[model samples]
Target: MNEENNLEQPQETLGQALKKRREETGMSLEQLAGALKLSVLQLQRLENDEHELLGPATFVKGYIKSYCRELKIDSQAMLELLPEHVEPAKKSKMQSFSRRTEKEANDSRLMLFSYFILAVIIGSSVFWWWQNSNQNIEEPVTTVMPNQLESSDISPDLAVAAPAEETIIQPEADVPTTSNETQSQVAAQPQTEKADPEHSEVVMHFNEDSWVEIHDGNGDRIAFGVKKAGYIMKVTGPQPFNVVLGKHQVVDITFQGETIDTSHFAKNRLAKFTLPLTE
Candidate 1:
């Protein structure tokens, strides 16, 4: 009976086990989370094994590792249970990312189609104007026959051959402008500083409290501190940014107005990404 009871002892979950160990050491969740340098929600999710709430799902292992470190738990013992919590999330993330890629491909196709149609319209307009302008140009008037001139010359005043009226062909100020010329002028216009396509900037907005470290690819630190919820940060530097976030679920990152998808790193619950994959 004793052997059976020992064998049947209920096992504690990852969260419960971690919580138990923390309490044994006289530590609070907030304090533990703070010690881990992450948000309380992140610690809660880790304790509860709320895999669904963990962003990028891939970072679960990373966050778990950090949490285990904070509690001074045996990493190998806890990590054996990690696969069970991590696999389902990996599958879900794959499906979601695939769908997003499909949508982006469709949007790109639509934009290309629109540009093609616009080019055809402009080309046709230019061709039509060229044909019409050539047709409208006045041809030189042939000299009147001498016989015909003499037949109509009954009046001496009319025979004076009125000082060959000058034919000044001044270009009309109100002449219709061709689309081709307009397009050429627009293409030649210089772009402003803000309008440069390659202009680089990194911006991050936090949804909740999180710790952040901003650095360059070469490891030079730029900014490091705990940022509060709704905190907005913009960075521009001599190097590409390597950003590390304490928690990523509520954080937003952008490069020149484009939203960056960092879901792949969400599993760590902490997020690390480079603004440009290459400097």
Candidate 2:
């Protein structure tokens, strides 16, 4: 009888037994709570033997049985530690769950706030870059002059004019005005034939029956001639000429007739002439 009573000595406290079982299973308070479908704080309180309220013996027994089963413990032996009430444990678990849920909600709010701040910083940076790029765009430069340009500078006049009054007024009193007077007289003179001493004379040589033509720098024909070997002509003027002999035969020439020698006459042969110009 004494041995039976010693074996049934109302085991250790619920907290002590729970702690021993957790240690044996290598589980933490949180791990045990997860296995028992209880909150961490509630499991902590139960392990600490802080049972202030009591309820039905049957409920407590069931709870103890379930906890022992998860730890692979002897259920009957573990149940000897549980109180006859379980209302306090249930309420404690509810409070612990509520606290954990609140903490999670707070953490989520903080994360969202951090993301919002990051978005604002990135958006501001992009806007600043865009604005700076627009400001950096180069504009074309324009040049300005103090004085406006004249029409004469753009397009010159082609008419000839008499000398200005300033030209007629001589700077040296001793120098004869006869030179200027003579120029005036010459300008007033009528346009009639008076030989100009300064004129060019040219000579032409014909090697065969040829046609000689005179042309200015602009290629306009000034004079032309068709001649046999002994035919010669004299012209008195400043003129450049082109001589054509048969097809694809050509030469450039200039002439101001001073003299000619057409004496030796021949046909289908060659002859030469001389020309001179006064400086």
Candidate 3:
């Protein structure tokens, strides 16, 4: 009886045992492959026990463990069927090594891209700042005279008038007058009008005769005059008025139309006012 029972005990290769269990369950090789999420070729290699096609012992052991569980076979019995010298595939080792290499390569590419973007931003910002700084630099200023018919208009004759070092003359006595006299004259003499001490003086000198017009801040024409080289006129204003001289000359003066001789006064007689007329 003991000899017969020993002969009845199952003894088979790993591949044969797996094949027997699969056939007993009426499962095709394709069905088993699908259930294991493996390709048909992979399952066929395992069923045939092809050592050359098998990757590593670890992969073989994992497959055996999973297949045994799914087929209701004992995992210990399946493991016992494998030869001691045959090793299963090590899938995790290869996958971990590949993943590390791929991650390093991706990190290097990202670092290079970051550096490139930073350099472009810094270079562009520096170029823009340089251009802006150059634009802010001021240019040399040149003076020009107007073509209006007023003593206030700076002309070519006035350009060559007095030397810069000449001392100005303040005549106390009145000069002789011509035939054109009016009610605006002081003491019936046109030249006897004295400068008001309370008002500030704004003298304008010209080379030739030119027309002068005065306007307020609201564009209202306050006064007009035709003046010669040494002609002097005065206007009363609480603040500086907009004095438009000739066709080009424009200035703001408190009391305008007073003239000075080029021989006695400074050559560049045009004064720079506080407010800039041109932008």
Q: Which prediction has the highest lDDT against the true structure? A: 1
Rank list by TM-score: 3, 1, 2
Cα misplacement distance, residue 88 of candidate 3 (Å): 7.0
Overlapping backbone residue pairs in candidate 1 total 9
lDDT of 3 at 38: 79
The prediction achieving the highest TM-score against the true structure is 3
Better of 2 and 3 by TM-score: 3
The lDDT values for all models are: 0.64, 0.50, 0.56
Candidate 2, 1-279: lDDT as tens digits: 999999989767877987887897799877777878877766665667655532345555666677778888888877666655545667778989999999999999999999999999999999999998887664322212212121222111110111111111111213345688876765664232123322233454444334444443334444343333444433334333332222112222334423333334242223222223222
Encode model 1's per-residue lDDT on 123-189: one tens digit a residue.
9999999988877664332223221112122133322322222121111223235778875665565
> In model 2, what is the error at residue 227, expressed in angstroms?
99
Error of 1 at 202 (Å): 94
> What TM-score does prediction 2 earn?
0.26
Which sections of candidate 2 miss by over 4 Å?
A: 1-11, 53-58, 83-279
Give stretches of model 3 more than 4 Å off.
1-13, 29-45, 48-78, 85-95, 138-279
Candidate 3's displacement at residue 194, Å, is 23
lDDT of 2: 0.50
